[model samples]
Target chain A: MDEIRIFAPATVANLSCGFDVLGCCLDTVGDEMLIKKNDLGEVRITKLTGQDLPLETDQNVAGVAAKSLLGELGSKQGFDIEIYKKIKAGSGIGSSAASSAGVVFAINKLVGEPFSPEQLIPFAMEGERLASGNAHADNVAPALLGGFSLVKSYDPLEVISLPSPAELRMVVLHPLIEIKTKDSRSIIKQNVSLKKAISQWGNLGAFVSALYTEDYALLGRSLQDEVVEPIRSILIPYFDDLKQVAMDKGALGFGISGSGPSVFALCKGNDIAQNVKTAINEFYKAKAIDFELHLSEINTEGIKILE
Target chain B: MDEIRIFAPATVANLSCGFDVLGCCLDTVGDEMLIKKNDLGEVRITKLTGQDLPLETDQNVAGVAAKSLLGELGSKQGFDIEIYKKIKAGSGIGSSAASSAGVVFAINKLVGEPFSPEQLIPFAMEGERLASGNAHADNVAPALLGGFSLVKSYDPLEVISLPSPAELRMVVLHPLIEIKTKDSRSIIKQNVSLKKAISQWGNLGAFVSALYTEDYALLGRSLQDEVVEPIRSILIPYFDDLKQVAMDKGALGFGISGSGPSVFALCKGNDIAQNVKTAINEFYKAKAIDFELHLSEINTEGIKILE
Candidate 1:
């Protein structure tokens, strides 16, 4: 039996103004998978460790993506799979993305890396599809390639990695709650007012411009979300207050991370990061909600194997 | 009278996926202004050098911006203004923006450069305000800065720049018909479907990312307008066919330059530019509409003195 092991990084999706367009990787948290080829011609889950997760590996997002990829190959080999989930699932830290990305990456290496990064996006999106039943690449791209990435097109080869600022330090805060990506997605309106769209695009344009120019102030200004944030924010406790506190603490911007419960704040320096983290923690404490805070630098190098 | 000359470059607003977020400057054609400080204590138009234009200088778009800036300063010194409209008025290639930017630039110089570029954006917005009755800076920023620019916040302070690909060549075609910016803006739906918005944002995200990576193919894939283009495109003759012609001729992408009556195509090389120009010219000849073709580079030097 040939065995392969791979890792994929966590990501923050719905990045402020980017919504479905932007995402970035995070270090120190992700999912690891080990796969070995067998002659059973059936996929089987051998073990699961770290973080309470589902045992039905076929239904598991990362395992599903791996199984789907293997199924598509029409290979007459069964696979033994083990998942070491490090990132807290549904924490809005791209927990599922790390799993999906890791599984696909491990499977690809095990079978000889046949597809390009672009080619793998759809396969990764399949994992996303299993998770949300809707295909999106904002999370998957960053999980695949570390650094700032964009989901330009989603079908017939999704696009990734537009211009990103070199100075990116994102501080994420996860409030105590489990918010499904589907539930968060559902809360959003089916239609958006054109006036709001214009404002949203205006900010998105500024965000993109700031990335190219390294104008941190402009990035701060453009980090506004008038469309999705306002609607979905209702799901998070003390959402508005948290944002105000983070901003008052000198955060460049604040937005709901991925499908919510977890919120991310963008800052300029380590001092700002520390300040934002402290402020966000204080906000949660004031609200009497138990939560966790992750104050790390932007994980420009996404997923990698651990020695 | 102290005569001073100022020039403003043409601009392409709503660059594909950017919609209201992104725009860039075109080097080929623009508007020019000659301002003469006088003791008359009021702005007066001494000459109109372009094609038939509003003779009442006060009502003119450029004149409005210039007058507003002067009014804000409360200067008793009068100014005699001469307008040289090189970029065709009412063409989608940011005709209103050139006037607004040129007048603002000329007035700034005439006033001994009283305000910084940041301060001048609002003044220029005044000109756009006169033209469209709404103050927006998507066109004005690029007209002022030349390369790809963003107005994260339409407020004067939040304007910034994004990266521009070095190999960008713009092929613009005007079919001689005038399309008012106001009318084009009105035709767009005041509401957008959420499904469409996701697709739009996805493309916009890709477009912004493409700028950083200089991925031409991704740029092409992302160059889609589902909301504004579909509704407003009906106004342009052979709009779809022209886009096909330009794309078939090697244009990376094609869309309405600003509003309508004029269209622009983006291509990678000079050879593609030449091919697009010939293709567009043929479209015009086939339709029996007299038209003009422009092969231009992305103008990185926005507003300048043309002697």
Candidate 2:
């Protein structure tokens, strides 16, 4: 039985009003899943490292994603799955998605890559559903396909690639606290005002336009969120303080990452990005919150096989 | 006093959910306003002709726009304003905007074109505000600049030019009826569901991405309206039937123009454009509703001086 090792990048989804549609990959944070085929005809959860995780292979997100792929292949060969935890679980940095994406990507290659990325997204989303009870592709997409991605539809999933500017940089801060995706999604009101919705749509239009045209100024202006951020912001401690600090130091815009506890700031040049990282660090120091900051370029290359 | 003739093209504002953010110019339907500076301190409305217009220039939309521009310039020199209305009023073709836009475009030219197209939009919008209580720049910006324009901000108006696809074609049909912008806006709900707003944002994002990448398929799919069109569509005659016919005839998509009575369909090819036009004309014919159809490429040249 041959052995395979795969790496999947972490992602920030929801991107403020872009809820299920917009997402981008981050290079620094992700997970590594290693798989080896065996003749036992039984999937085994061999080892779990980094943060404490589920031991049962069936209950494991990465294992489930791998199992789904293997089931599709109808292979009699069993496999041993091992996950090296890199992105912290429940940090809103796509911790679970890394596992799912890494496993799926590795297994697809093992099975001769029968499923396209689009075809694999739903299976990956099922992994997300196992973790959050909601099938969301925002995290899974960027994890699978590097750079900026748009999930046009999720029912029968469709993924579209968006233009990524070379100079784009991201400053993300994860405050040590847990905010479940399901709970965060529940706190938001089911309905919104039409006037506000229009404003959000306008901003989103500008955001997409900026991305395509590579207009930095317009991108900064368009990164505003009048719809979801205002509601979900209350869940994060010192969100306002951290955001203000980041913006004051040259961040273009800052918003909750996925369903928060983690926050990301879009920055212009490296100078601004470094400044934003420092500002966030200072705020966390003052607040006495356990937080980590990462200065990352847009991950144009999503998942890759390390070995 | 120099006598000059200027023509401002008709415009479509609120292109989908862009409400106040997106606007575009149309080549054919327009209004021509002639301005002559006079020694008198009082501005006088001189003549009005074409397309069933008000004889009284002071009460006319063109006069109001011209007056606003004069006020902005602090032009103490009184002017004689003559309007040749080519576009019909209340056709959802931005008739008043053409007059208002023409007044500003001509006044700027008459006074040496001091203000840029960006500067003229606000002055034109002031004129638009007089007719419709809402101060929206969708119509005026397109009339002044031509092609597709995005309004980033309104308080201190900021407008940006968006890329226009070469093969893009617009088919506009004016259904003979009166639907005021205010009335059309009023019919929509004050608020929307957050879930629905997310859907709208997703579509808007896809639409904007499509515009930048020139992806016609994404553009067609993204042209959906979950909030505004469903409610306001009732006001237009045979709105559903027209849309069905137009889409079946090869329109990429169709939607109510501005505040309706007029409907516009987007198509990629000229054959589809003609087919859409014929389909719309047939629908109106069956309903015994008098209508006019215009098949135009996106007008890159906005307001111009007519020799």
Candidate 3:
């Protein structure tokens, strides 16, 4: 009861239509973390490996997220944290979100489950704030609650967990390039035409319905981003060519994951996902860029307990 | 198969968050029309009553809609149409849509149903274009397909029918004053802040999810229109006062029905709907404005047959 080990998965945000609101968890790509209760009555990051991240309790994403939860309760109960990082920093696949969500999730269990998974979102968001100056729930939410999560509102912090279809799979490609969320976001215009805004919401609304009805084709048709993608996609290398090949290879939909450097192609089945992965791999291999490819099912369970 | 009488239902569009793409059908408030086959080899509005309207096939909404369907099929089949209009035009409750949707639905039946209710949407939309300069399908799609319908795309014209909750009710108040859709639309800014657009799509996506799960409270929370409501609500008299009273009376959510002059209060059940309606009636009466209030259930069956 004093110690716990878990898997903290990566996530894909801005799923084409629902910008800054929709995200999903990945099953196979994540980081492993260990948490142990300390009698010293102090929150500490005792071990950090595989990634050169801040070790200070006040500077680290996971450290800050853990302190936020403990500080809110005024409980001096402390813990020693260890993060075996696998997901790289600034790959745009919610790298910092996994660390933040994993630490809070682990600490909450050690304290006898004081809050529900939904309640853990804000605490995990503190990590996101430390990592990227903005406390966005799109990544940490799905990494906590799993499946598809929609941040309906931010002022009240309402996050709704959506149903995931069994056949859904994601083919993710990270080009080993870093795209800072802030720098990428700067290129986007502050104002958008009302006409395009209407189209965005129409596609997003249809996308939500497609989830409930399990209509894969409808989901694909609804996966359109006329507003943000046109502006932000320019930052990524060969973004347009990658999207075209993904769609031509039978991906249900394709878009820049989070702010970019990492892109995901949503597919109906593993067969199509593999085909898309291979096609993308072959297409990007000629670019002479160092990159990695990941194929994962929709992670229904967000953070998992390890043996 | 020579003669047919039918009831065409009214519809409420722009359900707050979904400005141009969402609408639902009303059960009790609509118009009745009668059509009889003729050997004149031309579409005609043989009789006109209840309200002043053009009888010419080119000028009339119903006649234009009917001709559009016939012309598309290259059919010379003629029909004598009698219009018994009950819905007042320019009230923003889809009055023109009822007549246009009604006539096309009846004619399709008379001609042995050459197209389904969904396929009849474009033909019904001709009536909308005749009534207004723009050919929007929010109202007509619901009146033809029944229940709640989302206009997912306008280019390829993909219309999706959404599930309606059993306890849902709508309280519609038409304040007699007319606000032209064109004029009302002009008040809305051509561009909106990206933050506001994100909020809008987030709420709309949640609203679609609420409809599927029948979560009434969530539906109420999701009925927010930050962009259009602030600009367009100014045209309606005592707009803020009426919305306040409806919410105070336990209405689920309230907003402008279409363009203006007409507003709708969404409530959970019949009792709440009636309470909201009565409160709105009393509030409007004090403003020295003539208004009509209607309480209606979500109409699952759009156009109905009559003896």
Q: Which candidate number would show the highest lDDT if scored against the true structure?
A: 3
- Quote the lDDT for A170 in model 3: 96
* lDDT accuracy of residue A303 in candidate 3: 96
* Candidate 1 interface RMSD after superposing interface residues: 2.1
lDDT of 1: 0.78
lDDT of candidate model 3 versus the reference = 0.93
Candidate 1 vs candidate 3: the DockQ winner is 3
Q: Which stretches of candidate 3 lie over 4 Å from their true place?
A: none
How much is the lDDT of residue A231 in candidate 1? 83
Tell me the TM-score of model 2: 0.95
lDDT of 1 by residue, A19-101 (tens): 88788887756678787887787776778787677768667776677777776787666778888777788788887788777
Worst 10 residues of 3 chain B by lDDT: B178-187
Backbone clash tally (model 3): 0
Candidate 1 segments whose C-alpha is farther than 4 A from its true place: A5-7, A50-52, A162-167
Model 3 docking grade: high
lDDT of 1 by residue, B58-80 (tens): 67877788778887888777778
Q: Which numbered prediction scores highest in DockQ against the true structure?
A: 3
DockQ of each: 0.62, 0.60, 0.92
